[model samples]
Target: MNPEIIGQYLPLYGEAAILTVELGFLGVLFSAVVGLFCAAVLYLRVPILRQIVWIYIELSRNTPLLIQLFFIYYGLPKVGIRTTPAVCGVAGLTFLGGSYMAEAFRSGLEAVPKIQEESALSLGMTKAQAIRLVILPQAFSVSVPALVANVIFLLKETSVFSAVSLMDLMFTAKNLIGLYYDTTEALFLLVVFYLIILLPVGVLGTVLEKRVRYAGFGS
Candidate 1:
């Protein structure tokens, strides 16, 4: 309703939006790496590590993300491990998103045909070589849609980081509301900024899904 009020906070809102993107990007990257590692361990049936991975997936998937964030930001301080709000927020997102991603990747790895590995073996490749050269590529293709979707979901989930004082978009919006007492304008801006960020990501995901579908594993 008030143009001056909205304009006054636009710069800060922009900064918060940028910070949100940075956190989401970092969170998704770390989570993807951890998820892939966990998936590989479980797929290969690694002795003790597989069980540990399973437990982590189960616990993380079952628990509330808010509690997980609290433990990282609050509980760790009690254990003599102190980190910044950003670090704890990123770590929390990584672990929480990684657990869901692990399942998607594991299913992808399992979907790879056994004969594909056999064919690689027939070519005189070692098991590791076969997996690296033949299986993972196909598995990655199979999992792309799911992985992308999960990343999108995790990006939205970054809002929860506000609880830890990370100045993400949602936090910035709330701060604006507190300062200006203009809930409608602040909330509208919040939705608009999020749409700007997430719309492109969603489109990219759809494009990736179609490309993977049409190209098939051979591509």
Candidate 2:
């Protein structure tokens, strides 16, 4: 109801929204890379290293993401390793997102029939060639829906970074509330901002899921 107050705080909200998107975008990109790499390593059934990767994945998946963020932003300094909150937030989110992302990829990889590999081999493709050319593409395609879901979750999870003093949207909203002493407008606007950003994404996810499923890549 306070147009002047809303107008004054609009720039802060916009800047914070951009930063939050940037963090989520970077986190999603790196997490995808990490996820694919880990998925590949597991698919190959590498000795010893596979076990280590499993432990890392399990640890990441089982623990709360907040604890992981705390460890990166708070605990690492105790070991004489230091980093900015931005760096720590991105790293922690990437690590946590990668675990779940890898599982999505792993399911896709396994969904790819073993016979496809055999067929490629029969055509004189090397083992690596078979996997690279025949398996990875189909597997990744089949995983599109799951990947989209993971990305949505990852983006939402970025809100947690505000806990570490990251100037994300939630942090900005909290600051505005402090400044205006108006929790109703501040919090309501915060929800509206998130809805504005996420609603389209949710729609896109649905569209992509249906398209991929119909194309036989998301079965």
Candidate 3:
């Protein structure tokens, strides 16, 4: 717990934290889109696409992010498809997060009563309009908690970005410890940085969940 050492490496950790956040944000954004699409396919029972989405969801959910990153960053190179570590990190996160998010969204969709859809349609709304305007809003509200949880989980998974040499927060801490043997200080900083990243998210999620529940959208 050397003050001087902590001071010296704080900037490095800050930079790494930004990179981790950037990668995590991108991953979560893309994964949400992928998840929504997959959930829609499954919800609508879209024939061939549903089966493909199911297989993808199973494969992604079953595999580890570490292995996925390894494949994207290392294995892809051998196949003549190269990507930067940052790209690999984002891609891996999206691939893994998508499945979890899909399940969350699908559950949300299913929780909405069938009568709701029927009512929307009986109002002369097109099927797509009913889904887009009526169903999705309620489903999303019901999904707020799970989606927030998935976001936090995916952000934490960014820790493994170091496996691909991405120089993320974990990588910075490990590098500092290896170079200076300041294990205690480095670990302290690591925990602090992670808190800095995740604590606000946790609090925000709670706030959103309460709001959703208060609005009568959550059970």
Candidate 4:
């Protein structure tokens, strides 16, 4: 509605968007590592570690990112464990996203027939070699859709980074509204920036999913 106002605040939103992307990217990257490790533990059915992974997955999935951020940013300080807001944002996102990604990867791993592993082992491949060479590729293909969804979900979850005092897009928008009382303009820019950030990811995910399906990964 207000082109001039929108233009004026564009730089602020841009800066916030950059921070959002940086933090989201880190969170998702670390979450994938965590998820893969946990999924591997579960898949291998490692003795005590399997139970621990399950507990972690349930706890992370059950809790809200907001609460996790609060605990990290506020509660941790009580125990003398201080962390910057950016760190808190990334940590919370990783904790939350890892669980979802673990499930995605676990489902993908399970979807692969047991015979594939057996065949790989029969061919004199060690267990690790069989998993790395034969199983992971196919499982990852099956996981593309879910992994894309989790990536998008984790990126959107960055919206709550403001709760940790990060000057992310949501924070910028709220700050603008508070300062200028430009509710419509602020919200409009918020939606526009969010769309700018998320739309391409959604499109890319769709494209990737289709390719994976065509390659005979998932239904």
Q: Cα deviation of 216 in candidate 3 (Å)?
A: 6.0
| Full-model lDDT for every candidate | 0.89, 0.86, 0.93, 0.92
Off by over 4 Å in 2: 214-219
What tens digits encode model 1's per-residue C-alpha lDDT throughout 72-126? 9899999999999989988999989998889889988998888889999999999
List the pairs of residues colliding in candidate 3: none
- lDDT by residue for model 4 (1-219), tens: 789998999999999999999999999999999999999999999999999999999999999999999999999999999999988999999999999999999998998888889999999999999999988988888899999999989999999998878999999999999999989999998999989989999999999877766325332
What local lDDT score does residue 90 receive in model 3, on the 0 to 100 scale? 92
Query: Could you tell me which 10 consecutive residues in candidate 4 have the lowest summed lDDT?
Result: 210-219
lDDT of 2 at 217: 35
Count of backbone collisions within predicted model 4: 0
In angstroms, how far off is 78's CA in candidate 4?
1.4
Deviation of model 3 at 36, angstroms: 0.3
Candidate order by TM-score, highest to lowest? 3, 4, 1, 2
lDDT by residue for model 3 (1-219), tens: 689988999999999999999999999999999999999999999999999999999999999999998889889999899998888899999999999999999998998888888999999999999999988888888899999999999999999999999999999999988898999999999999999999999999999887766324343
TM-score of the candidate numbered 1? 0.95
Task: Give the higher-lDDT candidate: 1 or 4.
Answer: 4
Superior by TM-score: candidate 1 or candidate 3: 3
